[model samples]
Target: MKYYNKLLLLACLSGALGACADDEIAAFKTDKPESIVEYEYLNAYDALKTYVDRTANPHFKLGTGVTESDFLSKGLVYSLVCANYDEVTAGNAMKYSSVVGNNGSMNFSTVRDLVKVAKGAGITIYGHTLCWHSQQNNKYLNGIIADKVVESEHPSEPTLDPSVISNGDFEDGTITGWGGWGNSSSRAISAAGQGHNGGHALKITNPTVGSDHYFVQTSYNVAFKSGETYQLSFYVKGASTGTGQVVAQDANYAGDPFLDKSANKDFAITTDWKLVEMKATVTADRTLILLNTGKYEGDLYIDDISLCHVNTGGGGGIVTNEYAVQSDFENGLDNWGGWGNSSTREVVDGGGYNGTKGFKVVNPTATNSWSAQVAYDFASELVAGETYYLKLKIKGSVAGNIGAGFQKKSDYSGRGDFPAMSVTTGWKEILTSVTVSGENADRFLFNVGAYAGTLWMDDIEIYREVKGNTIPLTPEEKADTLTYALENWIKGMMEATEGYVKVWDVVNEPMSDWPDPTQLKSDPNHTDTENFYWQDYLGKDYARVAIKLARKYGGDNQVLFINDYGLEGSGNAKCKGLINMIAYWESDGVTRIDGIGTQMHVTYSLDPVKQQANEAAVISMLELLAHTGKLIKISELDMGIADVSGTNIKTIAVTLEQHKMMAEYYKFIVKKYFEIIPAAQRYGITHWSPADSPDNQNSFWRKGEPIGLWNLDYNRKPAYAGFAEGLSGK
Candidate 1:
C-alpha cells in the first residue's frame, strides 16, 4: 500500500495522470516514520533567561561579561546577550586603567557610549571595578607619591664653557653640533622640553651592541691647543643600564685610529640622568670629542655638552646668565620638592602647555596657599640686591590661582613674591622679575595647594634668581592623598555613568595568596609597572574609603560588591580572609557593604577523587557566603574540563563524554547557587565566558579551554541544556 501510494504521487507529478483522479490522490497517504534526536535537541530550548523562575528568585539577575566593542556594534554577540542575559558587565571598558589616562585625565566617552547602548537594549550594567592593583595608571600614581627632590643648598658651579658648544642643549630643535653613525645607530634631536634644561636633547638609538663602544659615536668638533687642560661635561641617561665613554679623537676620524691621541674616559649610564665631566690635556690641535656608546643596546640621550679651556688663572670662564634651577621634568622630579595637604605631584610627559613634558600637581581641594607646596632650593642664597628673572609655562585643568615666591630655606620666611598668577586651560607663559630684599632667602616656592584641579608647569627657570632642594610622604599623609585620589576617580566614573550602573565591584582581588593569603598585596620592589596597590598606600581602610566614595557618588540605589577569584579553593582561606577583612572594614558601623562575590573559575576533573574534592570545595564556599547574611554572587563563573592525566583539556581536545561532564558540572554549580543562598540575598550569577575560549595564546582568560556552554561556532553544547535545567530547577 505504501509503494502504491508513492507510485501514484510520482505518476501524477510526471503528468501521467490517466489513471489518477482527485479522489484517488486524496487516498494516496502513507504513515510517517518516528524522528531521531541527538545533540540538536539542545537548540529547541528558548533563550537561557526564559528558564529562570522569577517568582522563586525575584531578585536574581542573569548576567554575562562582554567586550564593549562587540556589544556596541549591535551584532550577533549583542543580540545573543540581550536575548539571554538581563545584565552585562564590561570586560575592560569600565576599568580604572581604561578610563583614566596617563596624565590623570578622565575620558568617559567610551563608558558613556556603552551605557547608552546597554540602556537601549534594556540591559543593566554592573560596573566591573572602581579600584584594582593591576591595569592602573601606575606612572601617574607613582609619580605623585615619588620621593621629593631638594636641590643641594650649594649646587656645583657651572663647568660647561657656555660659548664653546653651539646648540649643545639642542635648543635649535636639531642635532646641529653633534654627528654619529654605526652599529645600526641613528640620531635625532628629541622633542621640545625633552632636554635636561627645558629645551631639547640629542637622542641616539643603537640597535646592536657592537664589540667597541666607538661603534656608535656622537662627535663634536672643537679647536683645542696641545698641553692645555680642558673640561668636557654633558648630562646623559640611557633607556637601560649601558656603558659608554668620551674619547678625544683626531680631526681625521675617517682614518684608522691610533693610541696616545685618545683619552678613554668611560661612564656607567643608568636610567637616571647624570652629569658626566672629563678633564684632560689635549694632544691634538683639532680635537673631536666623541661620545662612544655603541655597546648600549637601547636609546641614549645627551644634553648640555660643554667643552671649556681651563685657564690656570683659576676659572673655566664667566657663565653669565647661568640658571640656578632649570627644570623641564624630562629627568622626572629632580631638584623639585613638595609636601603638605593631600595633593599629589608627578612629572608627566606630553602633558605640558606646549605638548612637551611638565610637572603635574593634582590638588584634591583648595586650602591655605602653603598647604600643598612645590619648592626648589637655590644653589646659594639669592643676591640681596640682584634682580632675578623667573619664567614658566603654566596651565590648569580648570581656572585657578597659585602663588610663587623666594623664601628663606631655614624657616620658609618670605623673601619676595612674584606677581600672583591665575592659570587657565590654555598654556600661558608667566614672566616676572623679583629683587631679593632679604639676605637669607635660599629657596623658590610655589603654593599650589590653593588650586583644586590639575596643574602643569613647564620650562620653570630662575635665571640668576638662584644661588640654588623624596620627602617620602608620611604614612598618614599618604593615606589622605590616596583617599582623595580614590574619591575623585569614583566621583568622575559615577557621574559619567549617570546612575544607570546600579552595581559595582568596588574593589577587585584585594587579597594576595602568597606570604600570607590573608594580607593585602604589597610589592615593595614594584615588579609590575602597571600595578599600583592602593591598600599598600592607604592601609586596610582602602576598601572602606572606596565604599564610602561609591555610595557618595553612585547614589543610594547602588549595589556594591567586593569581587575576587580563587574564593572556592585553597580551603576557602581567601574567602575567609575576605569576610574577616570585610568585618574589619565595617567595624566603624558607618560603612555598609552590600555583598560579596566569588569568582568560580572551575574545572571538571576526569579523576573521581579530584572531582569529589572540587564539588566539596564549591559546597563549602557557598556555605561560607551564606553565613555572611550578605548577597552572594558567582561573579565570574566558567568551567574547563581536565583529562585523566589532570591536564586542562583545550576546546579542540574535548571529547563528547568530557563535554557532557562539563555540562553536568555547570548544572551542579548553578543548582547549588540557588539551593544554598536565601532568595532575598541572591545577587545572581554571571557567565564570564559565554563561548569556548579561542585557541590563541594571547587570550587573557583560560585561553584555548573549553570553558563555555556554547561552542566557538555558537552551536549549543550539552552544557547549555545543563545550565538551562539548573536555572529552571529541574
Candidate 2:
C-alpha cells in the first residue's frame, strides 16, 4: 500500500505540460541553421531539458521501498504475521460433511454455501483432501472397476463366420477350429485365467445356425467370513438370448456340479444390459464362486459388483452439539467480594469490584462518617502545576448530597482537602474531578459521608490529567460531573502528548460480577451491595457510552482503548463476552480500540519456581491479547510475600534479585514486542504506578517484601534503576 495522493500527481503533470511550440518542422528537411534544426528536433531538445532538470534537483525520484526505520517512524511493527482461520477451525459451522451418501449420490451445496459465507468474511478456505482410504471404501471403486471388466469381456468372445457353423462342430477338438479356429480357443483360454497362460480356460460348446453358438463359462472366487451376509449386484448383457446359471462355491469345479442348493442360481439374459442382484449368507468361511452355466451363449458381459455391511451403527456425534458456560456470581462467598467491606474493594475473580470489606457509609448525621482510602499513596505528590482526576464508583442509597475529595499534605506538616465533585442520590454513578492548589499536595483522602445517605465506592482511580484547567469547585458549582472529567482527560492527554499516546483505555471493567438484581432480592445467597454499582450509574451502556465519549474527545489522532484486568482469552467467558461487546463498539463506527491492559498483581510468591511460572502464565495471557492485533500492556505489576518477617536476609536478597530478574523480563518483553508486533502498531509499555512501597501497618506488607521501586524516603530503589537501565537497553 503506497500512500499516493492521486490529485497531487495530476497537478504536477498539468504544470509540466503547460508550454508548447506552435511551429511545425517539415519532414526530412534540414533547417537553414544547424543549431535551429537541432533545437527543432524533439528528442534532442527533450534530452537537453532532462539533463538540466537532473542537474538542478537530484532528489526527484520515483518508486522506492519503505525502510524499517521509516515504518517505525510511522509506528508500524511489521514482524507479527496476521492470523488465518478456515471454516473448520472457526468452529461456527453447523455441519462438517457435505455429502451424506444417503441415496447414493454426492451433493456439495452445503459446503458451497459455507465457503461463500467464509469468503464474505475475508476468511480463507481450505480444501480438504481429494482422496482418503479410510473415508472412501471399495463400494465407490467397485462401480468403476466393473465397467472396465465388462468392456474387456465383450471383445474377446467367440464369433463365427456363417460358413464355419455349417461346415464344422465348434465343440470338436478338431477342424483347425474355425480359422484353424482352435487357435481362437487357445487365445480365449489365455485371456480368461488369472495370468496369460493356457490354464483354467473358458470352454465353448455347440454350433447351430441362427441359434446361440456356444456357452461360455468363467468363474471368480472371493473370500468371505463365516456368518456374514454379502449382497452382490452387477449389470449383465448378451449378444443373443442366453440362459445363465450364476454359481457360488468355495473352489473351481471342472466336471462336478455345485452341491449346495443355495450356492447356485439361474437367470435369463436378454440382448440389452440389465442389473442383477444376488444376496448370500455364509454359514462358514468360504470363497465366492461365480459360474455361468448356460448351454447357448453368444457373449455375456458383467459389471458393477458391490458389497457392504448390513447392520452398521448410526453415524456418531451430531455436529450441532454446542457447549457454553455462563456465570453470575450468586453463590456464597463467591470470588467477587461483597460490597461494604474494606478488603473487598479489590477486584476478585468475579467481574465486579469487591466493596463489602471496605467501609460502608450510610445515612450518617455528620459530613464525614464513612471515609476509607487505600493504604498506599500516589506514585508522586500532586503539585499545583499538575491536574488529576478522581474516578470512583458510587451508588446512592438515598437521594442526598454526595461529596468525594482527595487530600494532600500541605507544608509537610498536615493534610488539606479539595472537593472533586458532588452528586445527588438517583441510584447513579458520579465521577468527580478535583484539582490540587498550593504546593506539595500528593497524598489522597476520600470522603463520602456528607449529608448522609448510604453510598458504595469501588475502584477509586486517581490519575494525573495530562491537560485541562482544574477550576475550584465551590458549594454553588454545577458541572458535567465525572463524565466531564473523563472527556477532559482524553482531550488533555491528546493535546499534551501531541498524539504520542495513541492508545487510551476509555473505561475499565464496567460489568458487575455480582448476582442479578431480580435473583438477589429473593435469594439469601445474594448480597445487596454486590449489585450496587451496576444498579446505579452504569446500567447496561456504561462501557459503550464511556467508549463513545472517549473517542469523541480523542479525535482522529488517538486510538481509543477499552481495558479490563481479567478477561485474557476465549477461555474466560466474561472476557469473551467483553470482547463481543468491544466488537459491537467497533461495528458502531468506532475503530479506535487499539489495545487491552491486563493487571498482573502478584501478592504471594507461592514458591520461587511457581512464582516464575505464574509470571510466565500472565505473560502468555497477555500474549493472547496481543494476538488480537492489539497492543498489550501489563497495566499493574506488583508482587508481595505473605511472611516477610520470617524471611531471612538471604531470602530478601533472593526476592529482590527475583524482582530484578522480572525487570529484565519486562525489558525482554519490550524487545519481543518489537520482534513480534508490527512497527506501526507497537505501543510503548507503561507500569501501573511508579512505586510499590508497602504500608508498615499492613500484615501483607511486612517482612521487608520489597514491592515497589522506591523506598518510603522517596529515594529510587534497585528495581527502579534496573527498570530504567532495562528500558535504555543497558
Candidate 3:
C-alpha cells in the first residue's frame, strides 16, 4: 500500500509539472518549502496554555490596539449570549441570554438578578438578540413589516353588536350560538385568527367578551401523560362578519389553559384564518383537549389538528422564520442632462417606472454644441410639506459643466431652461434638495450638453423623507457622520453638499521614496511636487476639519472624503501604506476617509490579463471598506493614450469596442453592487472626461489616438454610441 501511494503521488506530481512548462516548473520547485514538521496533539485546556506561553512575549498582541499580555492578565473574557425569554432556562446560562414574554406583562426580575451576578463577576453582557423568530410581540411585528396598504372602495360592515359578548360566558366551557367568525366585518376574526371585537380573540356582539363567539371542543381517544412531548395542530376559519381567536387547551382545567400547567403558542389571525400547528413539551397532562375560544358570537370551524409524542429522535428538524425584504430605491437615482447648440437628448430606458427606457444625450456639434431639454413626470406626486431628495447619473462630454434643477412649469418659458441649483463635471451623481410650494408638480425638466459637450444620464429618482416617531437627530446620530467619512467619498460629498463641506481630500497621490509616514506634507519648491495646491492650502486637518464642519451643518450628512489613487497592485504598496495613515486620522475623529478614489487609468498598452486582475483587486478592497456601510463611487475613469493608438480606422474600431466593453462592465458592477452591498452604501459612478476630446488627448485626440466618444470638434464618436447602447440595457 505504501509503494502504491508513492506511485500515485509521483503521477500526480508529474501531471502538475506538465501543466506548467519547464521554466515555470523549475521556478515552482525552487520556491517550494524544504522542511516539514509535525507537533504532538494537545487537549483544549493544554492547547490553550501552550498558546498563552508562546504568545506571552511583550511584543505579541492579540487584538487591535491592545497587546496579548494585556489580555492574558484580564483572564478569559466572557461573551454575552441571549435568547427569547420563552427559550431561556437553567439549560442555557449564557450571561447575555434574554427571556421574552408579554410586552407589558413580562417578568424580568429573575433574569435581572442573573445578569447582576454576572456583571459582579466581570462577565460581559449582551442580550440574546432583542428580536428573533419566536419571541417578537404583535406590536413589533406590525411595525417592522408595515407597508402602505391600499383600502378598498367599500369595507364590509358588521351586523352583530359587540356589546352582546361577555368573558363570563366562556369560563364554563359552554359553546355559544354566536354566528360571527369567518364573517365580513372588522368585528369578525381577520385572516390572522386574532379575536377582532376584543379580549385578544375575535369577539361577536361584544368585542371585549371571550364567550359570545362560537367555541369548539374536541376529545382525543388517547390518555394524557406527564413529562412527555406532543405536537398539536388545528385548522380554523372565521366568519367574514367578525374576528375571533382559536385556542387549544385542557377542557378539564379552569384557570388560564396555557398558564404554568400547559404550553401553547399564540398566532395572530386576520380575515383569512387558516390551519396552524404547534409542538409543545407536556409538562403535566390531562386528557388532551382543544378549544376555539373567542367572543365573536359566530360559528367557529375547526379542522385537521392532532397531538403526538415529542419524538425527540425524529427528523422534524427546527422551524425557521424568514425576514422581510428591503427596497431597492431607498437612496434614489439621479440622471442629469443639459441642452446645448446641436446637442440632442432622449430617454433610453425608463428603469421600470413607466416601463420605457432611461435617458441619454448625444453631442452633434463640431466645437461644443447643446441638446434639447428632456424630463420625466413622476407617477406619484411629492407631498408639499415634506422634504425630498433628487439624484441623477451624469457622464460628461469632454470637460464641461453638467447642471441639474427642479422647477415648476411656471419657472420655464415652455421652451427655455429652469434655474439650476447645483452642477458638476465628469461622470458623477449630483444630489440636491427640492422643496415644493403652493401646488404639487410631478414634471421635472433636464437639459444635457447645455454648452458644448456630450453627456448621458440615467436612473433618476426623487425620494421622500423616511417617516417615523424617532427623534430627528442626536449626538449618537451625529457621530455616525464620522463613521460615514471612513467609508465612501460620495457619501461625504453628499453630506457636505447638503450643508457645509466638512471633510476634504487635501492632497492625493504624493510622490515619495519608500513608504513615508508623512506623505501628506507640503513642499512648495519640491521639483517632483504633484498638485501642491491642496497640500499648501488645506493642512493635514483639511480633510478632517472639512468632515467636522460638514457634520456640524449637514445634519445627518456630515463626513468628508480624501480620495487618491495607486491602490491596485504590488507596485502600489506605498498607496496602501498611505491609506493606513488616513486610518490614523479616522481614529482621531479628524480627516476620515469617506472613500478611497482609485483613479482607474487603463493604458492601451496595459496587459489585458493584468488589467483584469487589478480591477478585481480594486473591487475587492472597495468591498472590504463597503462592509462598513459607507458610500463608494468610481471617482474618475479614463483610458490612457497607449490604450487607443493605431491606424485611424483600426484605432476608432478598437476604441469603440473598448468603450462598449467598459459600459457593459459598468452595468455588471452596478448590478453586483446592489446584490452584495446594502442600497444605503452605494454612491455613484462618474466618467472623468467627455467622450473623445482634448481633455482625454491620450485616447480622444493627439495624433492617431481616439479614446472617448466625441472628437475635438465635439462630434459623436463610436464610443458615445457604445455608451448609449449600454445605458439602454439598464
Best TM-score goes to which candidate? Answer: 1
* Global lDDT scores for all candidate models: 0.79, 0.38, 0.38
Q: Model 1, residue 28: what's the lDDT?
A: 70
Task: Estimate the Cα RMSD of every predicted model relative to the unseen true structure.
Answer: 24.2, 41.3, 30.4
Best by lDDT: 1
Better of 1 and 3 by TM-score: 1
Global lDDT for candidate 3?
A: 0.38
Q: Residue-pair clashes per candidate, as listed?
A: 13, 36, 116
Off by over 4 Å in 3: 1-542, 549-556, 569-575, 590-593, 604-606, 641-677, 695-707, 710-730
TM-score quality measure for candidate 2: 0.28
lDDT of 3 at 243: 38
What value does the lDDT take at residue 508 in candidate 3? 44
Candidate 3, poorest ten consecutive residues by summed lDDT: 36-45
Which 10 residues in a row give candidate 2 its minimum summed lDDT?
77-86
Regions more than 4 Å wrong, model 2? 1-503, 511-539, 567-577, 603-609, 641-676, 696-705, 714-718, 721-730
- Comparing 2 with 3 on TM-score, the higher-scoring candidate is 2
Ranking by TM-score: 1, 2, 3
